[model samples]
Target: MEFGYHHSSFATHDDRSPAAALVDRAQRLEDDGFEWLSLMDHLWQLPFHGHRDEAFVECYSGLSAVAAVTDEITLSALVTCVHYRNPVYLAKVVSSLDALSEGRAVLGIGAGWYEDEYDAMDMEFPPADERIRQLRDAIQLCETVWTEDSPASYDGEYYDVDDLYLNPKPDDIPVLVGGGGEQLTLRLTAEYADWWNLPGVTPEEYDHKLSVLREHCENAGRDYDEIETTVTIPTIIRDDTDAAHEVYEDLLEETDEDTTPRDEFRGLIGTPAEVAAGIEEYQALDVDRFQIGVPKNDPETIDRFVDDVMGEF
Candidate 1:
């Protein structure tokens, strides 16, 4: 499975110097043999345990900066909230980024979350059902912008665009959708998505959801395995098991969570051999790509895992 990394707004190393911190992280990702580097999209930061107060950079511009420096990695908004922008304009932004990145772009999108973002910005954040409706419309709008020739138009229930011309439509940039909701979301994935992103589910849940996705694709006359499965593997890897435990210990203290089995919750931890075993086990379950959200954003820790674990992988 191809391994990737995710950025965390929860904490920045040294201080709140987000610019320097992200550049540093990008450099490490390039050096660490990671195939893709994803940045989380957030308008309003949600602090789980008072770790960080607010979001640092706008996700679009942040991705631009990330694309500017990294030459070989796949880059994307880990999942842009659909309600944040009109889908056609969002496609333009993505197309421009893809041109800048020389075609190493993937679109990761999801229904909007964080009510505070909606409330603060005064954008209409509809209820869950309606938001999904908008998400579907947004996906369609993006497709119209990317694939249609001449000026394309759409009049969906939530989105309405008239005679739009995207002169420089991107070349074959794959669209990825986040979430494992079985009804509308999964059905959309089966119909249109090139990739599927899921989170916070057990292995049994994963199996069941994949089964459902396969069933949906069969009914929709689509091949199930054609959609690449990219999973977010939350993890903390260290050269030594004790070092890993120490990181988890610090996390538990910082978050005031129970320490028992904390490493398991964080994801594949332990020595390089043990970590490799865990990753291989997941690979057996048909996960082709993994976005590993590393806990410590330190250079040394990142380098260690890259050398000792990722190299082995």
Candidate 2:
């Protein structure tokens, strides 16, 4: 059970410059034994997680800054929306990051969601099926740009590249498709992705989704074991179980109750020992990695997690 730090919010660092805070946090995470690091790709904080007016940094830019400061920790967006940027440009951006990081880049992508963001940005928010198809097209375009030689041409339904020349090509950027849509998204994962991630799911839900992915792999004539499986677990750790619960309650108070239901705040929310036990449950399921989302990036909680729970694993 390898651990990754999922940097989901910047609200707590409002007093300081985001660059200073992000660099400091990235360095600390690498020193603290986190093998992977991810950031949320959003124009604004998600309604369920924080207030809309909170600080939000662009995804790839944050990863680029972290890349300059850290070594060894794999960096990525938890999931970049397909519609956010042109596929060709996105390929170049990620390739640049891979080159700068010396090949520690993973493209974690998904179909566009958050209709409110779409409206705010004046971007088209297509239907679910169309968005999934667009996501597939985007993945195909990126793969061609990253792998094939220069003067590559790809004809995808949503995007097309004619005589595209991508220089300084990256060496195999792993594609981690995010989402648990039983039909289209799982099929896309089986057909193309090197990794599949589903965040905020229960153990039972994860089991069911894994089974679906296996079926999709079989249908697609792909090996299920070839794809790495990762889950983002929203975690809160404290010295004692009661203290952890108090922290969880405080987080709930900050979040929008209408968007975030109480039950949705599921994951390792307890003392180090209790959190360690919960992690073992997922480890028993053969999960390849756990992306721990420590809300607000609390220093004490992060230290306790790395020192106590992660050490036990």
Candidate 3:
């Protein structure tokens, strides 16, 4: 499976400026054999990663910066929150990035979650079903804007567009839909997305989700092989198992000792060799790519992963 790196931790290290660390990590990941470099599209730091007040950069701006610094790696949000930007505007932003990156932009998006971000930023946090409706509508709107040559209009319950014109469309940018909701989300992925993300799921769970996604594809009259399957997972890699545990402990201490995202990934931790085995288990179920988050944005962990796990792949 191809490997993607998620720059999930934006808190500056005490040793260097935040900008320096971020650039260094992005460039290094590219040089180290990561195919894609992604950032989370959250304004506030999630509680599982660190204090909510810690440094967090805007998603698109940081992705542009990352695109500028890296030469070959594809750049995108792990999944942009649909509620944060208008669909037409977001389409322009994504196509612009594709232009600037020479067609290396992937649109990874999902139904908005993280109510705390919405509450803090005064953005509407609609009910879950309503948000899913918006997500479906936004995907349709984005696809319409990117492909239509003449003026286009859309009328949906959550969104409406009239004579929307988008110029300089992207060159077939891939749409990667994140989230594993068994109903609308999967159906939308089957109908609209080029890639489907199975985040934080075990092998058995991924197998089940794949079955559901295939059913959706069949019902939608879509070819299942056309949609790539990806997994968004937390990867903790070290030279030894004991050292990896130490790194995990350090991450807990930084987050007020909270054990959310860390706890969520307990089943996926190991040395590089062990991690490779874990990844192979997923590959057996036809997972095509992995987007792995390096805890604390540790560069060494990434380097080890490349040298040890990715090399095996």
Candidate 4:
């Protein structure tokens, strides 16, 4: 399976500027054989990651900076909230990044979550059903902007564009939808998404979700194999098993208690061989990619993962 790096925290860069640390990590990830890199799209840090006061960068802007620094690694937000920006504007932003990066951009989007962020930003957090509908509209609108000729018009339930002209169209940016809602989300993924991602799920859960997705694809009259599947797992790797577990415990101590429950959290915390075995479990289920989230952007863990586990696949 292809491996990607997902950056979720900017709070642990000791003496270096956040930008410097990000650039350094991006370059290293690219050099170390990561196929892609993603940043969490959050205005406030997620509770499990840290306190809301911790440093967090805007998603697209951070992606733009990384684009300038790396030549090869594909860049994306782990999942942009559909309600944060108008679809027309988002299409332009992503298209611009694709042009600047010479065609290495993927639009990973989802229905907005994290109610605390909404309240803090003074944006309305609509109900789940409405957000999911908006998510579909946003996807359709963006696709129209990218594929339709100039002066395109789309009338979506939550977004509308009239005679809009999007210049410098992207070189076919893939749409990756994140979330695993059994009903609407999976149906939408079958209908529109080129890639579907669900994080923090055990192998059994992933299998069940895949079955639901396949059923949705059938009902939608779409080819199930057309969509790529990805999973994100919080990872901590060390040469020693005990050391890896120690680091995992330290990470738990540093983060909020609202994190995924221990029994449900499908994180990888062990030696290279053990982590590789965990990855193989997903690989066996036909997952196309694995997005590894290293706690606090730990460089040593990232390096060990690349030097050891990656080669095992």
Candidate 4 residues lying further than 4 Å off, grouped into runs, are 258-266
lDDT comparing candidate 2 with the true structure? 0.87
lDDT of 1 by residue, 1-313 (tens): 8988877553575774777678767876887778887877776443432233444667778778888888898888879989777687888898888998899888899987778778877887788778778888888888777888869788888788888888677878888988888887888889888988886455566778888889889989999889998887656667787887787567545542355465345566577787777777667779878777665454555666677777666
Model 3 clash number: 0
Writing each residue's lDDT as its tens digit, candidate 2 over 34-56 gives 99999988898886687788778
Per residue, candidate 3 scores C-alpha lDDT tens digits across 1-313 of 7888878887555677666778878888888888888888988777677877787788888888888888899888889999889888998899889888888999999998888778888988888788888988888888877887758787877778888777787769899998888988998899999988866678888899999999999999999999999887777888787778778778757774466454555545778888888888898987888878777876677767777778787
lDDT of 1 at 19: 71
Model 3 residue 8 CA deviation (Å) reads 0.6
Worst-scoring 10-residue span by lDDT in model 2: 256-265
Query: Which residue pairs does candidate 3 place in steric collision?
Result: none
Estimate the TM-score for candidate 4: 0.96
lDDT on C-alpha atoms for all candidate structures: 0.76, 0.87, 0.82, 0.87
Error of 4 at 272 (Å): 0.8
TM-score, every prediction: 0.89, 0.96, 0.93, 0.96
Identify the runs in model 2 with alpha carbons over 4 angstroms from their true place: 13-15, 258-265
Q: Which wins on TM-score, candidate 1 or candidate 4? A: 4
Lowest-scoring 10 consecutive residues by lDDT in candidate 4? 257-266
